[model samples]
Target: MTATNVETTRVVRTSWLPLIVVVLTQIQASFAVNALTVSMAGITTDLDTPATSVGTAITAGTFGMAAFILLGAKIGSRFGTRGVFQIAVVIHGLAMLGVALSVSPTMLFIAQASSGAVIALIAPALTVFIATNYHGEQQGKAIGLLAAAIPAAGVLALLLAGWFANTIGWRWSFVLMVGLALINLLLSFRLKRVPAQPGLSIDWAGAILAAIAVILLSFGFSGLATWGVVLATPQAPFEVLGISPAPILIIAGLIVGQAFFMWLRRRAHEGLPRIFDLRVLATGSERAVTACMATMLFVGTAANFLIPLYIQVVQGRSSIETSFAIIPYTLSIFLSSTFVAYLYGRFAPRVLATAGFVVVASALTLLAFTVRGEWSQAFVVAGLILLGLGQGAIVALVFNTLLSAAPKQLAGDVGAWRGLVHNLSGSVGIAVASAFAVGILASSIATSAAEHPEISDELIAQVNLDEVNFITNEALAELLATRASGPELDAAIAVNAEARLHALKISLLSLAAISLLAIVPATRMPRQRAGDLPEKLEPDDDDLIDPVDEQEALG
Candidate 1:
């Protein structure tokens, strides 16, 4: 076809229907996780399990996505993007149904895990569909919308799941997801079909290695609080000699991760099909973009986790209260994600990304000083709004840059790598934040107790300070009720309150420091405007050459 014909074909094929379908698919995946978070109290009450069980379920879901996302991308190419997406959506809905019907913590953990694994299939296909169906600016806007769906779903889950848990039950939240999944599956028919590359071979060995590495890292970080950060605790299931299994698993994960990369280089040398496309990260700019993406996600996810912990645990507030308190932040993220595309043509990626990190650092510093006792304070609200704006812009900008850097044929790999980084970084962010905050809190409590004249060292010996976590003043009083009375009880509660607040402030400041450090990577992002990037491959051109064959020829 002539250039004019290709232009005409592109316009004719571009429809908002595909964007809507993919965005809804993203919303479905995001809503499931958010709903679980919002329904934590109800799930704990109904299942008669500790809150940590729900946390385990969340970690399990993260592990599932991180471990299988690379493989999921390969699966999408071997079959067809649309077909695999449809099947995955159906399976995810079934997993949600299982979540709704779960009677025990184990059931909930398995169901959420299944949902996450299936999302690995859906995530990559969303990017491939946009690449196949849109061009130029339209493609940029589509990616922004895709990024927006995440916080939009969070807002929806907070409102809907909170209301459902309060009135009917938490189960209704996932039931609603099942209904939406059905609608999304119906809408899947409208998406453009990308032909399957049946000749593409699966690298089962690399897939296993990647899966093992992700699982080890996820589990190791997640278990730090329970299994002990450096040494074995009484709660640890097993220990290596006297050391905690957590650190051992983390070290092993790093070794295996290095091996996975070496194996990929070998595959490239031999001209064999690999699990992921290394070309996506071949350039310095591309590597910098990846760093920027991971840093933004780590800071954003950590802030998100810390705020809720403070709201619900420190202040002894309800889920509904916590949800409403975060509305400004979530809404700001939605607005920024949707409108940031307009600025892409005016500014280079490096400029936008650097500015974004600076804003985030400033917001975190403000939050560290402003947050005292309440979530409704004006300064806290301002900080959250600022944080959301910076985070939303960076998330959208890096994604657009990474996608634009690669050929349309490698979109699946780009999408896969993005998914892996998003989940893994978020998991580590929460883990580190939890461990750091609790460690500080524990140390503060011990020092305060030692200094207080009313408390005795013998009393401290009776209680295990190492097992302490973030809890409300009321819960702390109940725990010490039998051991101490009158001024002693009062002093312990006072110590707990002051220590928790101090720990929170320190944590926010530390996160702010990390955000400031991220500016270095943002400065190295691509210097070109989005419009200056190469035009997207035409639809007919996409089907003409296989990505595997193209890689071999390029080598």
Candidate 2:
């Protein structure tokens, strides 16, 4: 090729490099932070905290993230992506450092919640970068690569976190995060500055309301296990499978808050943006995004949340053993996401998406039925693969669809909404699944206890709590090992097995139903190949505004 032609191609290709770095760094940070879940016990032990309290700290981080996601978008829009990206990275670094240095549970919670705020800022800006710099197949591939990196990084991080925690403690885990944020900060410099477009105004009220609604919704959903129902009733008006109303009200309130926000957006002025640009959600493709997010959460939660419970409680596996068992699910997501991105252009998205959901639903249904005493690792691995494949396809496809469907300038908005929905669904899925499983297990325990009066109080005490039921499975098995020789031990083991099987079945059924719901939205995904959309509809200079150069704005 002529030098002139070669140089032109290089320029075009190089334009995407900055965005690529941003995506990679974002994934790295996400993976590192989330890896903490696997080591939550370690964190609580080091800090002298209760497990439930530690979970609350983690949930606070999530609420903070959901609360500020839109604000991050607006910040990115005002300040160039470059500036917002840089600031977010710095804050994230500081937050990690703070967490590492924290001596008390209160400090740790504060630091983690603060870190969530920075994540909200950085995540949206990074996503917007992909939308603006790339178009067509390139854009789809970019989004896919970014999405794929998350699970891959997560698997890698989880594998290493155990060793890291063993060697230096959980505090050191955040130290690693600090280093990652620094790397992200350095790489962020190469990103092109999004020039500020005049006439853009922040909708303060809309942003606040949006943040409040999401925070309330997430809080309410997360509390489902503890609170049971949302409303106070005379006769358990909102009982689910015999559970009572305080928890469900949170879900109801979130729905109502969203409706009010929609009303606000409809009446708001043109220049100011509503929390969610309802117009974006009005599209068929957007429906695909919503479905994809919810589906991924459903599948991922079923695998991540329940498998650990099943293994630790029912199968009596250790955390390290459970993590290894889950490797296939994580790795499958990485592999499938990578493959699907390349294939998205070659095959119809609807076909791939539909097939993906089917795979997930099938695997989950099998899990419901096959969960028995002495199950093979092979069966679990196979199920994990199907789950991963389904989620990988959905995540990659949704990222591509949502960002592409959104206006370029609003990439941050799209990214925030996407993250919010995905994480929220995941949180809700786990909560609901846990509650369902517990309800079933509780019923089993009650029935079995009535029939097996000889069961020791010590054994019954261990069975009452979910954590004890999970981590002490082998211990429980040992306690009942003599059952092979006597009726007393035999009865106890039988009851334990029955309770576990019931829990597993209930959780799996819920997952299967959620995966089916995914089918409805996946069918609405855009059918065209990349680059088919009009250039005017894509992100351009008019969509963004450079942040006012104020020193105070620096995080």
Candidate 3:
């Protein structure tokens, strides 16, 4: 059979069970990460660490994924893709075991980081294998299932982690992942492995440079609040030209990031091996798909960070409470993501993407107005549902476009690019949300305090307002007693609470504006009519492969 014929009919030759196994990999990755975040309260309580430390583990996981994903792609191409994938799965399961038995915050970080690194390879391989194993409409449906796996995992994570963490503490939630991972490993055997390309070379220098750039960038963004956005804060170890090390690292990372791209360009010109083949990213459709993914992922990640943080810290709730709070959002995401796939052949990518953003911005605006320290309204829940629904649709559509549009050989490259955009955006989302909200909270408190007569100017001056961070009402009450008492204290608490609500509202509004601006790029997605695919997709169309040189040229 011709290569095109093999590619087109591969799925018709296989049992449907392997398709389900391919999707399970995605579910396991998301489930492990979400479980860790929702169980933050339990983790802090068990480990005797501050709740704020949970962010570190989350960031660490993103960093691991971002840094190693390209390298993981290369590794997959070098080794037999399926064998390497299976090894990564087993290692990831072991890492989850380590997380389950973590003795300290450091151990948890170590384990999660390892898991992130390994899954980086598996994520790309999942897409590549699906394309390799399935064809035509089956390929399209398989990609949709992979995309839906993201929100589906959240539903499962919240359900399982919430109950497990509540009953036996948070440690066992990760232990549960170990079992899921094992099941995935067993199911993975149903899938076949491709031949290894031992002759393929890696760009070690490019890999190192990219890793440094992303690591520095994510670390700087994560530490913006602690190390100061621009000026030197007390927490900062040193200053560069009287500016904080945080921004300096970010600047350095940008420089290195540009250099890394330049290095890739040079490598491609010289016809040497490269960590990432940038040709997949050269097309308009691919770039647009990437932008759409990054933009939506950023907003979604911020919401994910803020929701759990609020439920656990502000409400002093456990993992179960956080899960219950987010159930509506998760379920909405699942429905939207799954349903959007059926529409792929009905609506233009641009139209669906634009409508998605509109819904997202409107939902965010509603949430902005409805959110408060003690706020609970049916509309707020309704808004969250809308947010998930819209966000999920965009994720599915953009990713489906990306996978179908890019050539089959660059499927791994596209997957690596997807991982890079997603994990980095997630890291940036959490960091931006944290810094923006905290900064607003401190400023709003100072401004609001001056207006309230009971909160004297002298009292405000006595407290180090800039140093204040978000904490529980009980924690705030204890701290306030050290400074003032009686009606003054009551007045201060009320003002602080109000400031926090305003801060959260402002942050949500900012995200809403961002979502609105994202509509511009969403408009740029291929302007096709109902049932029309983007032009870039023709090269990889399973049913109509032309065997042209360009179709064969893009590894």
Per-model TM-score, in order, reads 0.92, 0.81, 0.90
| Best of the candidates, TM-score | 1
The lDDT for every candidate, in the order shown, is: 0.82, 0.65, 0.79
| Candidate 3 global TM-score | 0.90
For every model shown, the clashing-pair count is: 0, 18, 0
- The residue-by-residue lDDT of candidate 1 on 376-458, one tens digit each, is 78999999999999999888888877776655556667778889999888778877788788889899999998999988777
Scored against the true structure, residue 177 in model 1 reaches a CA lDDT of 94
Model 2 lDDT tens row, 294-405: 7777567545666655654456544455567678788888888888766755776677778888898888887777666544656756877888888887777776666555
Candidate 3 versus truth, CA RMSD in Å, comes to 4.8
Residue 434, candidate 3: Cα error in Å is 0.8
Off by over 4 Å in 1: 1-12, 48-53, 529-555
**Superior by TM-score: candidate 1 or candidate 2:** 1
